[model samples]
Target: MFAGHDPYLVALSVIVAILGGYTGFGLAARIRGTPGLARRLLLAGAAGFLAVGIWTMHFVGMLAAPIPPAAAYLVLPTIISFLICALVVGISLFFVSIGDPSRQRVIASALLLGAGIVSMHYVGVHAVSGPFHIVHRPGMILLSSLIAVLSAYGGLRIYLARQGGLRLVLSAVAFGIAVSGMHYTAMHGMTFSTMPLDMVPMSDGLVASAQVLSLVVALLCFVIAAGFLLFLVPEPRPRPLAGFPGGFYPASEAPGPVSEGLQTASRSDRSVMTTAPLGGIGQPRQLPVQRIPVEAADGTRLVDVTEIRAIRADAHYTMVHDGQRERMCSWSISEAETKLDPAVFIRVHRSHIVSLPHVAFLRKEGDGAIVELDGPQPTIVPVSRAKIAEIRARLGLTKTVPPRH
Candidate 1:
């Protein structure tokens, strides 16, 4: 017969689940903005932490249940259960992270993940061998499975939406509750009875005694706690621009007149930017931005303005294309236009800005036009009808009129 649960251990199990969810989802949110090896690493880390969290929580909950002293866990089956959880969780994340995930793909991934969780739970349960027979109620099993699927679906949706700050914390809390609820509900529907005197206990493989299992669970709890704390620390911001007094000039202020000797310094000698004093006065002279600040999930990074090929508006934010990939920026389209040098960067459309120096090709498309930007990943940015003529002139594509016949 099942005994009353240890309230302390039960609470610890829920905490582990929440921490795992928080770290996993936070890493997954950055996968979109990262490229190549970095993206793969983030994905792996996310999956590993999440799988460990699930496995850890289950065992902790199991420990809380006062099972008979005769019960011991089979080593192979217990390990296999964790592998099942990891494999399915990794597969689900892969599906959602690659390209644009459609509704069907998301739903399918969630179902797969849910099924994996259920399988892991049952496999772990069966791994326990003792002098008792376990019986489960069919209704409870169905209800637990349903809860797993629904919870997985909700978690995936929140991740895709990129809900940060308080929303992400709330989602993690909800996930912890659902995971714990499923475990306890299944336990509620199960009853244990003593086996017949003639029945022999299973002893085919290595088994973990309750004491040994408890130690392993305790170590894992520490690991999860450390990871949770590490994730809470804010990522470092981009370093200040070098060679400028009090860092770079504020957006509203321009650099004051420089001494003649400093202005005469060769461009090659200057590491960041060259300065000039116009008319020997303190009047503000418009200077092109040398670096643009962009945002990633981890922190802010400054992208070289020369490397930027195009910028497209994303709601209030902007996506800066630096030939290789597009990165989210905190600046709006209008704000980006004002900061960038007018001579090199042009506003080709209300929602789009392009670096004129990087334009490789231009052609008429419908009423508007299209521009092919040169980069590792070719980008085609659209030009609005009203701006088409301006873009053509900017790109030196304006046709000259012949002398009058």
Candidate 2:
């Protein structure tokens, strides 16, 4: 006889999934803009939590059921399932964070993750050796797979929406529920038949349920403690400097998109700030733009600096292209230029500031140059001769050939 509804394992699964959500958000933040050893570390860490959390939750949930005949898992298959979960989770995070958010890429990631999760669930289920024959319903399996894919998309969306705070918690809870939901749903779809009394004693896998549960519980404790310590470390609030303008904020304060201490061309310093203007002096300076909220006159539009493809001058106004739509801003291109971070937004023309991340590549076109942005349909913006050297340097190209007479 077996008793279901074990409280200990259920609780551990919840804890593990919540911690994994937070880790996934952090991993997404670290994946942006640049690639390095640090980013790789974030990827590996998040993969462990995301994969292990689901793996642990499923097995723990299985134990909570208290099924009959004292079933135990095959160690090799159980470990293999965990590895598959981890790899899928890692790949999804990689696609969402490191690459451009294309429609096809996002869909592919969701489907891949969904399929891997389904595979992991079944593989883990197969690990059990018991005195019962497990029968599953096809409809329930399909329904559960849909839930996993949607959950994958929802998780990625939340991470992109915000990296920290209550958003992370909500995303985690949703993820945890999806995991437990799939397990229980599949469980509900099954009807187990007990083997004969003589066959019961022939069961090979030894019960190590207690040992496994104990290990998961310990890991959950460690994850909870580390999460609080790393995320809860408070920062001293910055005292607002009166009238120094928004650029006065320290570079460390810059959020996910841009690097810290990114210099902007000042009114008097425009001549020395960027390459084409560096040797020249007394270029009219513009103020740095904070993440300003701008909308069209109809009040139906909004754009973020991070979303900008390029800003084109239109006399007294500037046009902002966010890859999806274009909106006109009241500010001139010069005024908008200073408000952008120099590291990621470069002055390609006197009339344009190109968003660096969207730039696919540069092309030299008949004694001039063009900067192309990445998307389904690419946009090419002309680069001025004066600003060409600066653009090259920004893209990390250092070798400059002198003009031949």
Predicted model with the maximum TM-score: 1
How many pairs of residues collide in model 2? 3
Candidate no. 1 TM-score: 0.65
CA lDDT scores, all candidates in order = 0.78, 0.66
Estimated TM-score for each candidate? 0.65, 0.59
RMSD of 1: 12.6
Q: After superposing candidate 1, which stretches have Cα over 4 Å from the reference?
A: 1-3, 243-246, 249-405
Give every collision pair in model 2: 267-285, 288-339, 289-339
Assess the local accuracy of residue 253 in candidate 2 as a C-alpha lDDT between 0 and 100.
26
